[model samples]
Target chain A: MKSGDYLIVTLAAIMLIALYVNMWSAPQQAGDRVRIVAEGSEPIIAPLDRDHVYRIHGRLGDSVIEIHQGRIHFASSPCPGKQCIHAGWLERDGDFAACLPNGITVTVLGRNPRFDAINF
Target chain B: MMRICHGAVLALAVIGLAACGRNAGEHSYRLFVFGTLVDITTYDAQRERSDRAVQQIEAAMQQIDHDWHAWRPGPFTELNARLAAGETVTLDTVALGQIRRAAQLSATSHDLFNPAIGKLIAVWGFHNDDAPSGPPPTPPQIYALLSARPTMKDLVFGDGNTLRSTNPSLQLDFGGYTKALAIDTAIAILQRHKIHNAIVNIGGDMRTIGRHGLRHWRIGIRHPQQPGAIASIETADDECIFTSGTYERYFEYQGQTYHHLIDPRNGQPARGVLSVTVLHKDPAVAETAAKAILIAGVSQWQYLAREMGVKQVLVIDQNMQFHATAQMASRVKFEITPTPDLNISKTVP
Candidate 1:
């Protein structure tokens, strides 16, 4: 309980805090799943799988669409200019994916539904 | 007891601080240059070797730039200016040798990897730092400038530094292959300098000279759409990895995107693919593979990779999906978290 001992403890605490912050702030971990649903359609469902990474290929109408796992998002599409793809990834619930070209809206539903059938 | 506690704390603090200062044994350097190689190596001897190699490369770049740039060479600055004037310039032995090798590869790639795109690039206003502010050029304007532009075949070489152009409008630009060529040239330089192990990253075009001690060079392929996101990391022994993507240098107007990678099929920017990374034994091959894959677009990429017999490649499409050749998947040693969605389908074989 000496004053010098208090100083040492405080220094060690600060160092630990700094280390924790550095580790915590280091980039987002990769397992977060992002879902995309095509608007007006029967809810086009795509889920990003952790075991297998998905690649979004080609354009959806005017919007560039990416599907990974079971999730889908707009990568970049050539609608009028290509404003949607430039908007980047949407991983959170309630995030809306829009493709002006096809009038497709991909919304991320909070819950991911399990598939009853597997299609080749 | 109090003294013991203070001593323990001091010892622990010293250990922690020492750990912070500990060198990883491997080092990296990043250089941003319009032209010239930015060689990064682990050892001091290798660094010196890279320095010498870059010196020669800069000299070679200057030689080619002088032959093509609009500043001097006056009227000769035009594409095929030398041929039009009927002047045959004697190239140095190194230039002649490199050009011969590059020309042969250019021929093989069906001019898909043309070093002669200099004239076309200049016409597109990319050579200038301050590009002309206006709408993109019309098709007619593009055609007028590039219609009669020279092909790689126009370049003819003879004994000594002597080079001739069969066409009067053929301009020689080495920008496309120069960096990759520099990697090869620098490796050669390092070999001559007796330095064995190094890594040369000329603006993301990476080449590993030799292994650093027991460890191989591990390079990460950056995701095209996401900045600071690594698509995959691969280990290499002595090979090189070259990547060309639409994201590199691009400007958006209204809604259209204009990037640096111009499709030779059309004078406009290439679309569909976000990025293309090529793994090859030589930097030059990697460079060509990167360019060819981008030009071929997404659907044709697998076909092209198979035809070219390139074992390793990573292509990210506009949809933000990742596609890799079997070779690329095998080479990957690590993946960053939130690994981008990847599509792994067999190339027709």
Candidate 2:
């Protein structure tokens, strides 16, 4: 109603804005599940039957790769030249795994009937 | 007049309340140091004290880098180089002591965590940015160099820092343990400066000296293949979380891949196990666990952990399956993708 009240209201609005910005600016949540496969290891077909998709965590040399859903990607790898994590995710079904350092191979397969045996 | 008086009183009250909220215990400060610890947070009785403690720790880190860095020529470095060159160099008591301890560790680990891999790393262009633009060295090249590699036993330490190496090609590289040593040194410096509560994270190596308010330090383990992806979050009291993943270094050529973790047995990058995280009181153990897990592979890691009495470790296998020790399960909460089949059983420790 008065100049003093208006100034107080303005300051309160600014404080609220700041609080909201801080809360929203928090770090993004990582993907729900990560499937890490090593090179020469057998291809594992974990069920993607659930509506929730999964991510592939593997290495391409020293760089780590994270393939979210069906896309192949890099998370973090230790390669001296970190070019892999930047390569983005692989979308196709038969795409080669992005990780090479630990001889890791990752792939997304259709949910199979045999998914029940492998425990998390 | 009455309205003005009331406004003045309200402003004073607001300011007083704001001032009261700024009490000593409410504020927390985080310190970021690039070397030794990647990130650390500390809170002190006063902001000034916390800043002073950080400054002192930074100074100590610089000193550690100066003395222990393979690129630098400190007493130990000079002595190690001279020993490799067949020239006898006098050593100080402190240098001799450190060498002796390092030698024992090298022997105990059976050279898995060799402190003498500097030349090999340099040849691979790990130290220099202008690496040779070509395919990684062939298997034969790696093997030839590995065969001639000097054993830790070749190092001969004596009183007065005098030392010699039987192999002229021996080059000391403390990459594996130097960072841990720096963390210890910084902790000591913080204690000396009378700062009791601090968390030091050098890269992914973490050390928490004391509690934060009533809560333990919470650390998130980055997923091996996911950049900025946290696979799990764990809490520790006066412990450190040190991790090493296979993705740390490597190159790909023609669909083939090469990584930095060389298997001592075959002179090629170790296979299997995406990442290894060790939780313990000693940063060195965390460091050693990372290296050892890479060398030992996934199946052997569990046995090794049990034998070594290492309580906490998380190993993600090649199948995208996640496995954690009992201790790790207790400390870490996991989020599995595609919903892993959860199985919990105690293997003999």
Candidate 3:
């Protein structure tokens, strides 16, 4: 076989290994994005690295969410229970906090989520 | 010829990599129902078919939430009112079926999962969506309700759809049990639509069918004290994972936290355990067992789990210690570092 053919075969083998490594390697360390889903609206995805406060108008009222230092939490919410605020900060992948009455949820998203759902 | 073969090999490699695009065939829809978020995921399905299944699931779940609302002015509340007024009520077939199943489960848990303590639940101020910020009920109030000793046994089912409660205080609150029913209903809808691979997650509790493409669906049990999972489990087909935790629904009062998992035995939040997670194929059984085990506390969880036919169980005590059944220990991978002192106990035959 020609050296060009051999090189092509070698390149193909290297490419296959690279693809496998990309697919099967360890999941990235922590969540890098926050996904917010509110009723009657398209879900919003934002980078986790930026610390900011955002408000989404929900069924009950506005739910105030805060992103601080690579973490997210419900700063305040119109729902009577305030359970969303009580959920504290969500910094890890697959972690989520929801205001049921208000119909808003904040979830951390990463390359490979740790679980399909979190059972509390 | 050799060069052509190499080119073919490279072409196959590229195609295989393209096929491995993450989430290529995954479709997910989320809705707020049953007083919480319901997530429906379908893998390798046509978009139209998955959308139709999700639409039906949303409609069915909304119907259940409306028909069975415990505190709201609804059919279930009307039934409770009639039962309180010493009137025999004829229930619809669906209501009758659910009540009968809940009663049987209550018996199996030895009344630790009593749905007849609705009066106690109300007295604790948990009957509403508004989190109970307690000036907790006085002991006299709790004792007065406790003295009635209301239970599912108090409900007399007389011939076909007819029912009555002997005790006026015997109100009905399905709580987690009803959520389980909703999950099951969602699964049934997905199956009817021919969506074999899916996960139905109501709030944090979930039930999974088929798989996520190639592997079993992975689930995380939320840590009561930490941000991430306490442990992870790879679920088999038609498996339901239910957890009852102090963190789910609770309020703080006078420096103490009171959750909504009311114990019929004490007419207060079940104490001594932080959380309990149960795995089983039946959603209702898993849901009721998680509640019963949490109420059973550390000393009697195993006995209660055994009685309820729940082989996989995990309990986190007040001290942050993990107690898992042998079956559960074999299935769960603890995600915590140094794996906080897990004690494995035998699930006796």
Residues B1-349 of candidate 3 have per-residue lDDT tens digits of 7676867677676756545554346788899887678888888777788898899999999999998889989998999999999899998888899999999999999999999998899988888776878899999999999999999999999996999989998999998898999998989998998989999999789999999878899988888986778789999988999999988888889998888998899888999999999999999999999999999999999999999999999999999989988888888998988977778886543
Tens-digit lDDT track of model 3 for A1-120:
777777777777787777767666765544489999999799998878899999999998899999999999999998877878988999878888888889999999987776777777
Better of 1 and 3 by TM-score: 3
Candidate 1 residues lying further than 4 Å off, grouped into runs, are: A1-120, B1-24, B27-39, B44-80, B84-86, B130-134, B159-161, B212-214, B333-341
Any residue pairs clashing in model 3, and if so which?
none
Provide the RMSD of all predictions against the true structure, rounded to 1 decimal: 13.3, 11.2, 4.3
Chain B TM, cand. 2:
0.83
Best by lDDT: 3
Q: Cα lDDT for residue B119, model 1?
A: 60
lDDT of 1 by residue, B1-349 (tens): 6765875677587657544433323343423233322435643353444566556655554554454344345423543566656677776786577778778776666666666666666666665533223356678977865677567787778766788877666666665576766567656765676666667667567777667566555555654654333544534567877888886555665777677777766677788888888878977777887887887888888776766667788887888777887767766543356655566658633
Order of candidate numbers by DockQ, starting with the best: 3, 2, 1
Q: Cα lDDT of all candidates, in order?
A: 0.59, 0.58, 0.88
Give the worst 10-residue stretch by lDDT in candidate 1 chain B: B28-37
DockQ (CA atoms), all models? 0.03, 0.04, 0.51
Using lDDT as the measure, name the better of candidate 2 and candidate 3: 3
TM-score of candidate 3 on Cα atoms, chains taken together: 0.88
DockQ-wise, the better of 2 and 3 is: 3
Which portions of model 3 show Cα errors greater than 4 Å?
A1-31, B1-24
Please tell me which model should have the higher lDDT, number 1 or number 3.
Answer: 3
